[model samples]
Target: MTHVSTRPLEQSEFDIWQQAIARQFADAQVAAGLWTEEEALDRAVEANRTLLPDGLDTRHMILLRGVLADGTPIGRLWIGLTHPRGVAGCAYLYDIEVDPGFRGRGLGRALLAAAEATARDHGATHLELNVFGDNPTAIGLYSTAGFEVVTQQMRKRLS
Candidate 1:
């Protein structure tokens, strides 16, 4: 197994990473029947538009690219600081996606460990992430990483 390095994303890497994330979310939407292909595409387009502009500020909302020993990009992780009350120094684990070809090789675990270390270095006592109930793999990963659900949020879309 090769070691992975986390580095802030460059402006040139935004399009590639955005497309990758859009594809992943599209697949998830299709699998969950949450949207049709057209809907997924529209949503993806909007999402890309929203995120691509923020690539310039790689400090507060940092985007980290995970690279293999030989410098091949294998995954992406986003860590953001929280501003919610009573949650000082809290960090949000935004998006974590490992390339399909690199799944089940402990890359996800390594990426998460890196995120936790970053949070700790930033003076955070706790990290939080929102995982869909259907995403058992993510839930398992978070559980193994010592994160437990402090509360459950239920929502109903009225649209």
Candidate 2:
């Protein structure tokens, strides 16, 4: 069996993770129709800045690096404590990524499991996230991980 573990994001690696996070937010927002590609890029920068004013030290957010038993870094995961609208206590998966070189291995599944354990430790009873509608791969993964659609939005482009 392979062993996967997570560690708190080190100060030295925060810069790289921050850049990747910006990209993820922009891409996800564009996919979800919440913003155009350009607008997503602009707003991603602004939103991330606000959410992570102190970088990894930001309150209510947990950032971790995924590594193999031998200490080979393979991915990053971001989880946050959030209360969306009527929901009172929940953990939101802000981001999760497996390095390009490490893709297709089940690292993502491991990361999600880690997120749940960490969230529980923080007193979160529910978990939530927003994934781009078009990404069936991610949707399927989340579904198998026990996440179901609580709400859905649809849009039509008109000529």
Candidate 3:
């Protein structure tokens, strides 16, 4: 079995990751009908500012880098505590990504375990995250990792 571990994300890399996440999250919100493109972008910016008031120095968020046993960084996982992006109180997995080269090696699964452990450490009974419906791979992974759907929204475009 391959072993994995988590460490605090370094500021240099976190900056790049944060910007990308905010934009992507905004896009996802638009796709899900949670907000219009402009609204989603504005909300994403506001949310990031509120949660990371001090940028990488914010204490309310936990930004972690997943590494292999030899100390190679494979991915990053962002979890929000003070401001759960998914639900009011439950810790939210704002973003998690395994390097393209590191995918399919069970690293993603390891991160889920680490996230659950971290959530539990913070007294949360469950962790919530939002995955775009089009990403079947992620949906399957989360399902196998013991995550169940809380609710869903569907749309039928009438021609």
Candidate 2: which stretches are off by over 4 Å?
31-33, 84-86
User: Which residue pairs clash in candidate 2?
Assistant: none
Query: Which TM-score value belongs to model 2?
Result: 0.89
lDDT of 3 by residue, 9-85 (tens): 99888888777878988898887777998688779978888878987778767889999988999998888775454
TM-score, prediction 3:
0.84
User: For candidate 1, lDDT tens digit of each residue in 78-138?
Assistant: 8776633447778887788788899999999888888888778777788888787779999
What ranking emerges by TM-score with the best candidate at the front? Answer: 2, 3, 1
Write down the lDDT that model 2 would get. 0.83
Q: Which stretches of candidate 3 lie over 4 Å from their true place?
A: 30-43, 83-89
lDDT for 150 (candidate 3): 87
How does model 3 fare in lDDT?
Answer: 0.83
Question: Total clashing residue pairs per candidate?
Answer: 0, 0, 0
lDDT of each: 0.77, 0.83, 0.83
- The order by descending lDDT is 3, 2, 1
For candidate 1, give the lDDT of residue 116. 83
